[model samples]
Target chain A: MVVAEVSIVPIGEGPSVSKYVKKAIEVFKKYNLKVEPHAMGTVLEGDLEEILEAFKEAHREVLKDSKRVLSTLKIDERTDKENTIERKLRAIGIE
Target chain B: MVVAEVSIVPIGEGPSVSKYVKKAIEVFKKYNLKVEPHAMGTVLEGDLEEILEAFKEAHREVLKDSKRVLSTLKIDERTDKENTIERKLRAIGIE
Candidate 1:
């Protein structure tokens, strides 16, 4: 499983970006991936290709309204061990 | 408190990016931020200004060797609530 952390920032959009974020969340949900929306960004767990596809679609969705959009993505893929948001926190002794 | 999720990617760099990532992590550690390094990127918790300063320094550090670098940052600041990695996971019932 590939766990991706993504944050899409719409430049020039006022301080409030809940609308764009909501749309991005909708895209993530459409993928049927397990998503956890955090204060900073959203955590998604699924196949890498699916996650990348979702990212692209979400970027396009946001770009439709905003002139420029910055999407930050971090993908974690491990063949030896399964990784989830919960497991990552557990590895760091957060629990 | 502000929690920032940052991922620095050096474009054109070969598949191995551990060196650049290590430098970035060193910068994060120097700021005395509580950092949790995961598979994709590192999660940093500290004051907003301090986190931004660290990000700049880390970006510079990586740029010394790579020509093009992409840094993605997400900041989460909530005046009404104290947020932490643990709290975030707990909010989603991960724990």
Candidate 2:
């Protein structure tokens, strides 16, 4: 399994960007992945291919609304062990 | 200031990717940004423009050696307050 954290920033926009984030979250819901939204960004857990595809959609969804967007992603994939959002948090003692 | 977490994954490469990661880290060191290399990825603390530019360079650096690269970035930028890697960890009681 693969887990990724993504944050999309729309440049020149106002300080508040919850609306754009909401749009991306909406897109993520359409995919077969677990979504966790946090203060800094959103975490997605699923297969690597699916995760990357969902990320692409989410990026495009936000880009349609904002002219300039800077999206950040951090993907963690392990072939030896299963990795999930909850498992990662549990390891860090957050879950 | 902005703090971003970035991860670069080179596809089709063997499971071991430390070499590619090392190359990207070297590029990040050339900028005036604070670099914190963690288990999963690297955290960068600096201005938004500088961080983005540095990210672009780091991405290119990794891409040069790898045939296909998948990069992930999570940027946290605040206009009202200063944000650093240390402060972020301290907030979560990691420091």
The prediction achieving the highest lDDT against the true structure is 1
Candidate 1 error regions (>4 Å): A1-3, A6-95
Q: What is candidate 1's lDDT per residue for A1-95, written digit by digit as tens?
A: 88888888898777566678878888888996888776567889888889999999999999999989999887877666666767765553444
True-vs-predicted CA distance for residue B78, candidate 2, Å:
21
lDDT of 1 by residue, B2-68 (tens): 8778888798686556678877888999996888776467789988889999999999999999989
State residue B47's C-alpha deviation in candidate 2, in Å.
26
Q: After superposition, how far is residue B11 of candidate 1 from its true place, in Å?
A: 0.8
Of the candidates shown, which would achieve the greatest DockQ relative to the real structure? 1
Which regions of candidate 2 are displaced past 4 Å?
Answer: B1-18, B21-95
True contacts kept of each: 0.15, 0.25
Model 2 chain B worst lDDT run, 10 consecutive residues: B74-83
Per-residue lDDT tens digits of candidate 2, residues B1-95? 66778788887588999999999899889999999999999988887667666766776677567655667777665544456778778989998
TM-score of chain A of each: 0.90, 0.91
True contacts kept of 1: 0.15
Model 1 per-residue lDDT at B19: 74
Q: In candidate 2, what are the lDDT values of residues A1-95, reduced to their tens digit?
A: 66778777777578889999999899888999999999998888887667656766676677677655667777665544566778778989996
> Candidate 2 falls in which docking quality class?
incorrect
